[model samples]
Target: MAEQNRTSVAELVLEGLSERAEVKAALFVLLLLIYTLTLLGNMGIIVVIWGDPQLHTSMYFFLGSLSMVDICFSSVTAPRTLVNFLLERKTISFTGCMGQAFFYTVFVTTGCFLLAVMAYDWYVAICNPLLYSSVMTHRLCIWLVVGSYIGGVLNSIIQVTFIIRLPFRSSNVINHFFCDVPLLLALSCASTYINSMILFSMAGVIELSTISTILISYIFICFAMLRIRSSEGRQKAFSTCVSHLTAVTMLRRTTIFIYLRPSSSYSPNTDKVVSIFYTLVIPMLNPLIYSLRNQEVKSALRRTAERITVRL
Candidate 1:
């Protein structure tokens, strides 16, 4: 009976970001612009990092991996969102919804781990400059990235497996633009205590572990910077870390707000607004944040542009 009920709901309707016609139209245009910029900005970073020998370091490798993840992460929902804005009935099939949730979890979790890895990279670079080259080798960088994806895939499989087994009997209307675990949990017919516990525990573990890594890395970095007697040296070390700190704060706060709590406390409207920032806006902002603050990236971009102009 539970299995039958679970399979009964073939499709689910999404409430999306807005209901009013004018709002939808405006958001459609706005999201389109943001999505375009996200692709261009992230892709531009990847290309610049790849083409420039100056950026052939562990730091830039991680940055390139992050750009690729942002592209995948945003793509999980952005196109469907744009399409839904045109359609009267915003619906997703059960398979599609689960798939979206699964991939979204995978990419987002991977991104969190990657950020932690990058934080560790910064720690090594700033705290142990002499050993940075030896510590963060190309092989080690590749393994770290692969491990992040592995962790993401494992978490996603567990979470989505439990979610897919849930019997969503009646309510097929999800209260957000995309399929999220909390919203989906609310739609299930059976008691979601186990599911909620699993969600909170899994999310908590990821958040706690990653954030702890970042915090500890920064703490060591701070100590290392303090030992440097020169103000200029301290400032240079701080500059390297500030951009990553900004991104971590932005992403961690929203994710903790959404996932590390009970589903009963979820505010649909608030979640939707926050989701927009992380999902659509953050990807667009990451490259800008990194590139604008980074002189090396700026130099690379300038050189790349000059080369392109010469070719043209």
Candidate 2:
């Protein structure tokens, strides 16, 4: 009976952003444009950092890692979504949905932790300038990046395990654009009390702690900047952190809203809009956020362009 209940729904119908033919076409075109730009923007950052020897620092290294994450994390869902928008019958196999859920969880978790690590790096650079070189060694940065990935995968595995075990019944229509924890939990016929407890309690704690660390680091950074006597010196000090500050604010706002809440409170309509922001809009905007206001990145891009022209 238990096994029968689980196999009842093998493929899920994705009720995406719209149902009208005209709306689907518009959405497809718009998303395609955004997705193309997202790829170019993020890959452009990675390539620029790689080609420019001047950017071979702990800060740029982390930035490059972040670009990679944005690219990959966006890729996991965007392509499938684009495909579904065009298809008459929007369906994903159970296995594919599970895989999507897992990867989505992993990349999102990794991105959050990476932001926290970057915050710590900024704190070290600003607050402890003299010790920055000694503390944020190349070895340590690599470990931090690697550890974030490992931690994300581990967390995804645990969460996906809990979710996959729950028996989904006759209701196979996922109201959102993609398969996510909240939507999946809503679909499950089995008792999701334990799942809700873990998601709200465990996930909430992690998000809260990460945000607290970021806040504390920025507090110390503000104090450090205030200590600078010269206006020029203070501005210079603050410039180094502005891009990161913006990125953190954008990522944390949508993430905290989506994850740190009770399952019962999750309205599919509101959650889907938030999902589009973090998964699609944020990834598209991240590279622009980092590069547009950044002089170093602008200079590196110019140098990279000159080198490419020379090669041509």
Candidate 3:
């Protein structure tokens, strides 16, 4: 009977970001612009890194990977959101919702690991300059990225397995713009105590672990920067890490706020807003922040532009 109940609901309705038609239209336009910029900005970074041999270092390699992940991460939710704004029904099949949750979790978890890896890259470059090239060899970087994806996939499989086992018979209306763990758990008729425990434990293992690595790496980086005799060298060393630090802070704060807590305290309104910032705003901001702030990226862009002009 419980199994029958779970299988009965073929589709679920999404109570999206807003109820008002005007607000929906406005949000649709705003998010469309943000999504467009996110694609262009991240794609531009990838292009610049690929075209400029000078930018083909470990740092830029990681940055390129980060941009690619950002693009995938944002797309996981944004297109559905835009479509939801235009549709009156705002409905998704049960399988569709689960797939959405699964992919979002994978991309987000992968991103966390990627950020931590980037921090380690900075630590090696600053503290162990002599070993940076060997430590962050192309093969190692590739494996690190592949390992991050594997970790994310494993995490997603665990979470989604638990989710699919629960009977979602209470209600099918999710109170956010898209499918998320907390929102989906709320729709389950079965007790989600174990599910919540798993989420908390995963958060501890994934978020806390990655955050600790980043913090420790930065500590070493700061110590190394302090050892630099020249003020200009210190400033330059610090500048390279600023953008990554900013991105890490932005991602960590909102993610911890949303996922690390007990579901009993889940506030849909606040969570939805924070989700917008991380899912929509951050992707658009990351590329612009890195490109505008990094000297190497700016120089590469200038060179790429000059080449295009000469070609014409």
> Cα lDDT for residue 80, model 2?
94
lDDT by residue (89-190, candidate 1, tens digit) is 999999999999999999999999999999999999988999999999999999999999999999999998998888887889998999977788889888
User: What lDDT is obtained when candidate 2 is compared to the true structure?
Assistant: 0.87
**Better by lDDT, candidate 3 or 1:** 1
Candidate 3 minimal-lDDT segment of 10 residues: 1-10
The lDDT leader among the candidates is: 1
The local distance difference test score of model 3 is: 0.90
Clashes of each: 0, 0, 0
Question: 2 or 3: which has the higher lDDT?
Answer: 3
Can you write out model 3's per-residue Cα lDDT over 1-312, one digit (the tens) per residue? 767766567899998999998888899899999999999999999999999999989899989999999999999999999998888899999999999999999999999999999999999999999998998999999999999899899999999999999987668888898998777888888888999899889978998789899999999998899899999878778887888889999999999888887556778889888999999899899998788778888999999999999999
Show where candidate 1 strays beyond 4 Å: none
Model 2, 166-254: lDDT tens digits are 88875999998888877788888889889888877757776877788899999999999989899987876677678888888998888
Query: Would you estimate the TM-scores of all the predictions?
Result: 0.97, 0.96, 0.97
List of clashing residue pairs for candidate 3: none
Candidates sorted on lDDT, descending: 1, 3, 2
In model 3, what lDDT does residue 280 have? Answer: 87
User: What does candidate 2 score in Cα RMSD to the true structure?
Assistant: 1.5
Which segments of model 2 are wrong by more than 4 Å?
1-7
